[model samples]
Target: MNSLFLAFIGVGMMAAGFALYSRFLGSKVYRLSAKYATPAHTMEDGVDFVPTNKYVLWGHHFTSVAGAAPIIGPAVAVIWGWVPAFLWVTLGTVFFAGMHDLGVLWASLRHRGQSIGTLSGRYIGARGRNLFLVIIFLLLLMVNTAFATVISKLLVSTPTAVIPTWGAIVVALLIGQAIYRFKWNLPAVSVVGVVSLYTLMVVGDRFPIVLPETVMGIPDRGVWIILLFTYAFAASLLPVWVLLQPRDYINGLQLFVGLIILYGSVLITHPDVVAPTFNDNVPEGTPGIFPLLFVTIACGAVSGFHGVVASGTSSKQLDKETDARFVGYFGAVGEGLLSLGTIIATTAGFKTLANWEEVYNEWSAGGVNAFISGGGSIINEGLGIPTSLSATILATMAILFAATTMDSGVRLQRMVVEEIGQIMGLKISALVATIIAVGVAFALTFSSGADGSGGMLIWPLFGTTNQLMAGLSMAIIAVILTHLRRPAWPVLIPLCFVVTVAMWAALLQLGTLWAGRNWLLLGIDVVIIIAAIWVVVESASAIMRARKAPAVAWSDADTDAPAPHHVG
Candidate 1:
């Protein structure tokens, strides 16, 4: 198929999924009415109660939802054929993703906009909340490390992508500052930001940043890990308005513009997907089907990580209950759109290339593994960029995307872990707290991307784990919607299905990797397997407990209704 045609089909499906699934049915399930929902939920001097606008809320919600997992998962899953990658992204978004996201926001609405973690305490009971926190804290840790590995590879490989990415961010920050502080018109500032991003791209193409010789002294992989850690630390300590939020908004804009450029380029060129979406035989070492494909293509379908975003950080900043459904469900649709774009780019110039297997193997050199890991580089050559430069550009894109997510993940993990630590009477100081958070992040980053596998197997684990989390979240939402006794089936059916599939996938992975007994793989498998089982058990218990609770009349208080009671 022509890459252009595929792009159109995939995008159309994504749009249709949002319209048919989320706008009409999901909106009903997650109902976001402004009047009944509290904004500040009793404002506090610091933390949890900060009032934020929908735009900035977009930054928090989107960056949370958008991460390294999407790019990596689809790239590897394409090993099974684009059919699974494209279908999972499209269908999953409509039925399952929309429900999970909207449900998360809906549950938060009941506790005066409290986070899912907090609501678990009040609604599900103390033990469920504790169990939820343990999963969440560690999930954030894995996320931080995974993204760190992604970025380090990108920085080392793609010298040119830096200037444009960082420049777009600086431009975004200045514009954000001008708008929020100086009271500039948002539309005008946004336009400037767009223009600046393009200019940065042009210059980045002309003169991308290269790593210094000293930095390059270390092995190509080792240098990347060190640089990534240093970058993560700097990013964590900075203020959100300056780099965090603005960069996110810009990233969203970049997502929009880059996708358009991709679609347009394909339309003009009419490039064929030269290689079949899936390879015929598995690579020498990798498995050919089923379990691996399910693990590899995790983000396209469902992710455990999204749950953390939905209930943990984004919930804290929601201004109205209704907005949560829009942000949560729709944001995922947008991310689906992103994965589709990467697929198109990989397939775009395939017609001219020979020896697809050789090209696909080269992708592992850098972060190109995330976008074109199993695919040939026919598209890269067709773009008129040298193979090396094309690879660098791809690497830069992944690294920047990973950097944005890692910064946010570390901060979130810090918040949750610190909260837990304080409750445990650990007496951690502010500086010590910073170390604890960064310490965990560093531990995860140390040997990441080391296997020359370029972060493929790990991605499925990320996806499965993330999906498990989302499933647990869906369970919470299912229990809540059923308790409310408003039209529940629309969301609940998908809810049950996604959790089952995701849990099945995660458990399968943990076991497979454990049997493989690659120690690093084993460690990840163990952590995630335990977490998934806990979530599945918690979700099942939540459902049973809620079902068995004494019946309440229609429109009973959301809080007074029984919470999912599974706990530590």
Candidate 2:
């Protein structure tokens, strides 16, 4: 079949979901209203909680949650064949991810923008909240640490991407200044920011920057990792308006532009999907298609990490309560589209079934590299862009995606650290929390050796870990809905589905880790499995408590915060 069919089907399904399903969720379920003041206004600090335009906020939310996972997830999961990946990305986005992201945002908005980890205490009890925080901390640690190595490796391998990748930081800073400091018009500023970013891509393609194998006696990859974490530390310390928000907003727009190039290329070229919809012949060591497929494509489908990003940063910047549907649900849709595009690039970018088989000969094969090579080929073939430039464009896109997520990951890590401190009755300043966060990420990054590859040591567990987080976040949201006396079926159904599959996947990973004698990961996996089950039990008990107690009044539910920062 022509890849265009997959593109059209995926895009159409996601669009319909966003248009119809999201509206039902907003009106019938969430009942979002502008009257409820968001934390951005109530807790406005000109830093983390500054009120943001919904468009800008959407961009920020979209890009931060997106990261490189949407691309990497689908690109890898197509190893099971495109049909399962496509269905999960589309259906999961509409029903699973859309609701999960939007619901968590609304839950946080009503609660004064507490992280989902903190919200656990109100609904699930103190012990559950601590366990929740541990999962969140580990997940963020994995993200910040793994992504540093991912980005550093990319910088070293794709030297042409280095300039545009880092050049985006400068573009974002200028965009932030223009929008906030000078009060410039947003559209004009966006055009300037995007143009400047692409111009750097061109310059980067013309004059690539290749770091030597050693820089001041540090290996190139190690140097890049250090630089990346240092930059993340600095970015975390800045006001969101000055860096994080603008950078993410612009990168979100740029992703759309990149999507148009990719999807549009598919439209013009009309390449055949050389891979089968379902692989009848299984590759050796490939896990069963059912649970693994779900977890493998977590981000595009129904990632728990989205819950983290939604509750951690997005809720705080929401200008109005009603905008959650757009920022959270549609942000999910944007990622679904990216994942769909990745499915196409990987399955159809090759010339034939034979060529595709060569790349998909094993389960571990196909990811960002496949997306870049194949997507680049499609762009070059359709738009007549040179392959080198197309590769540069895609490489830079991947790098920027990782970089933005690293920025948010570090910041979220800081928040989690501070929350943990609060639980211990210790007052940790933001500066100190950020240092601890960055320090932890750095320690993990270099734990294995000077090459900074240790970050990926626990990466085998990320898919399950991320999905488990989503499940836990949804549990918190469902509990909140139960308290409000609203129908929580929307949240409850996905909650059960994701948690079951994630737990199953976690257990499966335990077997593999045990066989391999990887005691460290095995121990970590055992702890996560135990903690997750404990929290789920506590959440179930909390639901019973909410049911037995008096239903919370809507007005009271929305306005019950004691203080801005102390709500959690």
Q: Which one is best on lDDT?
A: 2
Please give, for residues 358-454, the per-residue lDDT of candidate 2 as tens digits. Answer: 9888887888889999999999999999999999999999999889999999999999999999989999999999999999889888999888999
Every candidate's CA RMSD: 4.2, 2.1
Using Cα atoms with residue i matched to residue i, what is each candidate's TM-score against the true structure? 0.85, 0.98
* Candidate 1, residue 98: lDDT: 62
Model 1 agreement with the true structure over 23-102: per-residue lDDT tens digits: 66544655555654343444432244445566666755665567766676666565445666677777776666666766
Prediction-by-prediction clash tally: 11, 1
How good is model 2 by TM-score?
0.98
Question: In candidate 2, where is summed lDDT lowest over 10 consecutive residues?
Answer: 559-568
In angstroms, give how far residue 225 of model 1 lies from its true place.
4.6
lDDT comparing candidate 2 with the true structure: 0.90
How many clashing residue pairs are found in candidate 2? 1
Identify the leading candidate in terms of TM-score.
2
